[model samples]
Target: MPAGIRLFLGYAIAILVLIGLSLRFVIDQAISMPVSPLGVVVMALLAYTIFTTTLVLQRKEAARGLAIGLASLTIPGVPLAWFTFAAGPLGIVLAGLTALLAVALLRGLTGQRTREWLSEP
Candidate 1:
């Protein structure tokens, strides 16, 4: 596998871990009242991410687009990280790191090596 794919897989795994950690909050909200629509949407997106990651691992040509789409989704989070930065200096550091990671992921996914590797049989 190419470095780009490896990076994306790592990112996907990290996202899955975060989703797992947040499941308790999502479930608690649901148990106390009506299901949170945001939770539902997040779950759906998680499923899609998992599916796309699997396809990429299999080296399916279509996965290039799917993976690119997934990487693109992270772009919005860069600015959103600023909301967390309001908490403290730690938040500021975290926000900067997250923004950097998002930008790197986008570049890695769209890099020429990644495109060539994914396009191969």
Candidate 2:
């Protein structure tokens, strides 16, 4: 597989794990209080991420754009991490690492090698 695809898959898997963890919390919150709209949105994102990851892994031509879009979506998380840095030092590290990964993913996805590799049958 192309490095770009690997990068995307790794990121997607990490997101899936995080979402799974958060879903537990969301479920607990729902049990005690009114369900938040954010929970619904997160669920939708989780489903989309899983779909995109599967297509990308299968090397579908359409998945290139889907992977790019998914990577683009993660860019906002960097600033969100930074803004929430007051919570802990981990926020700073998270923001920096997320930014680095986002940039790398964008570059790798758009690179010539990745483009050619994905274009193959």
Best by lDDT: 2
Candidate 1, residues 23-90: lDDT per residue as tens digits?
Answer: 88888888877768968887998898899998898877888888878887776775677675777677
Return the TM-score for candidate 2, rounded to 2 decimals.
0.84
Please provide TM-scores, in order, for all candidate models, with all chains considered together: 0.84, 0.84
Clashing pairs in 2: none
Cα lDDT computed for each candidate against the true fold: 0.82, 0.85
The count of residue-pair clashes in candidate 1 stands at 0
Segments of candidate 1 deviating more than 4 angstroms: none
Clashing residue pair totals per candidate (backbone < 3 A): 0, 0
RMSD of 2: 2.4
lDDT of 2 by residue, 1-121 (tens): 7788789889999889989888888888778777688788888889889998877767777788888998998799898988888588888999999899999999999988778767635
lDDT (0-100) at residue 89 of candidate 1? 75
Q: lDDT at 73 for candidate 2?
A: 83
